[model samples]
Target chain A: MSIRYAILGFLSANPLSGYDLKKLFEESSVFHWSGNNNQVYRTLVELHNEGLVTQEVQQQADYPARKIYTITEKGLAELRQWVLSEPELPQIKSSFLVQLAWADQLEADALDDLLRKYDAEIHDQLIVVQEHKRRSKTSPQRTPREAYLWEAIMDNKILYYETELNWVRTVRETLNEMGKDK
Target chain B: MSIRYAILGFLSANPLSGYDLKKLFEESSVFHWSGNNNQVYRTLVELHNEGLVTQEVQQQADYPARKIYTITEKGLAELRQWVLSEPELPQIKSSFLVQLAWADQLEADALDDLLRKYDAEIHDQLIVVQEHKRRSKTSPQRTPREAYLWEAIMDNKILYYETELNWVRTVRETLNEMGKDK
Candidate 1:
């Protein structure tokens, strides 16, 4: 159901083919909020069948005609309704925390290895987020609100990465001290 | 499997009854985690049967003897393995986006109402996250790393809330302009 809105939101902005949507999602930091080719294609078909979007088959010089989707008036209304509606609260079902809750079962050596892995993964994420921040700057028409929103989002991402790194280091030190006690 | 670790982790930190463990999760934002009594009791029974935790009966002054659980070495070993391993990345699945994708089904007025609902919810979440930050500061013994880690987690929560709020506002303005065209 959520995927339905995602497609509408994109089409509301501009007409696009399912392939174009997939490309945008993968190539952008917004990839975090993305769908696969199958989802995009299926939804486009559904929307076209429902008359929410009008599809035009345009021939390419060297390829098969593409089915491009544009939002219909009814579709725009639906999109507007969705944009205004309250978002459902996200649920956290992290498997990482589940593992952490049972960390006492781990040997000191294994715990150290785990902490290291967490550190590295967080570091990698930090790099990706930083790159996203850099890319956002290329768009010249961003409003003040959009600027602040992106800043807040990037700051939060960086903060999480930094925090996780700190936690791993702290745990590593604590484990080392325990080893000395033995 | 996740529930098993949560029970074992709590026992590893200190011997606790099923009721006590439930209280701990509720009392602290340690994991921003939660569960009901039914789930708690069921996990405890499972862990006991698995020999991951040993239970001791302790009599209280005016109540039935409580069963306290302590983590077994075997449980600790299992927890260590989970911590060391890399977990599968969590995918973001949002219904709001789906609603937008199918927006052509809705009326203009309906769309506006949805945006207002989103605005109110984001504001509400922002208040809760801010309050949680203020309340967390009462604990003085936390290390700089722990403090940063906690702040970072809150920052992420706040960031997402702000992002949705800004998006709603922008979409609303766009809808208004499009209305004028009609």
Candidate 2:
């Protein structure tokens, strides 16, 4: 549902082929669509059907024909409507937390191991988010305001990861304290 | 998929009817399953079919029969496997962020309105998380370690909300700064 709007959002800026959009999404790792590449093509086809986007085939001499997508005025209006709609509080549905809730059944050592593993993963994610922030700075087409909003988005991801890492360590300490009490 | 494991985790603690499971899930709001009540019933059926749970129907004089589900040995084994599985870094997916990415097209005042709306929604969610934390503490069944884990889950939700609120304000200020620059 959101991928459609995001595609339209991307097209609102400039016309892009599926390949170009895919590349944009890759660079957009932090808040990219949940689905893979096929979802992009599939959404483009659906948008074409809905008249939200127009596609033109660009024939290349050496490469196969490429389909370029541009958002129509209708698509822009739709995207605008979405922006003005009520913001649903984004739910943090963490399965790791679920595991923590019921993982009392696991031995303390095993549970601590899980927390350690999660902390390690968060560490790696922070590195990737740094890369995202770096790459995002290179997009010169965005206006100064857009650039600021984009940085805010990156900060959100970084804040989330940092909080998770802190929580993991806190839990680990709690687990150790419990073990010591035993 | 995570919900299935969560149900098994609940059953591992005690046998429960579908209705009872639903109530537990409601109280477990900090990390509750994404699906509605029907998904609980559907998952229970699937678990029974898979021989991971056994269903016993109890007939009452004044009420209809209720199905009680008990996790089988297989279910316990499956839940353990899930707990031991490598943790997946939970992707932070916010369609709000996606909107922020493209919403530079909107008037500055309009974008700030969206951010303010988001801030208000997060405020409301923090209230609910507090209520959930209060309700969670009343459960006498959890061991000390389990209780600690539950509190950590609450902390996780609180931290997320706080971070999001902070980010929203930061973005609003950034918008203001950009407006000044213009």
lDDT of 2 by residue, A24-71 (tens): 777676545544679889989999999999999999999999999989
Return model 2's CA RMSD, one decimal: 2.0
- TM-score of each candidate? 0.57, 0.94
Off by over 4 Å in 2: A137-141, B137-140
Q: Give the runs in model 1 whose Cα sits over 4 Å from its true position.
A: A31-34, A137-156, A170-182, B1-83, B87-182
Provide the lowest-lDDT 10-residue window in model 1 chain A: A138-147
Question: Judged by DockQ, which candidate is best?
Answer: 2
DockQ values, each candidate: 0.17, 0.69
CA error at residue A42 for candidate 1, angstroms: 1.6
True contacts kept of 2: 0.63
What's the lDDT for residue A112 in model 1?
68
Native A-B contact fraction in model 1:
0.22
Model 1 lDDT per residue over B3-119, tens place: 566666566667889888787667544344585788888888887788878889999999988998888888777755555678533333445434443343456677567667767
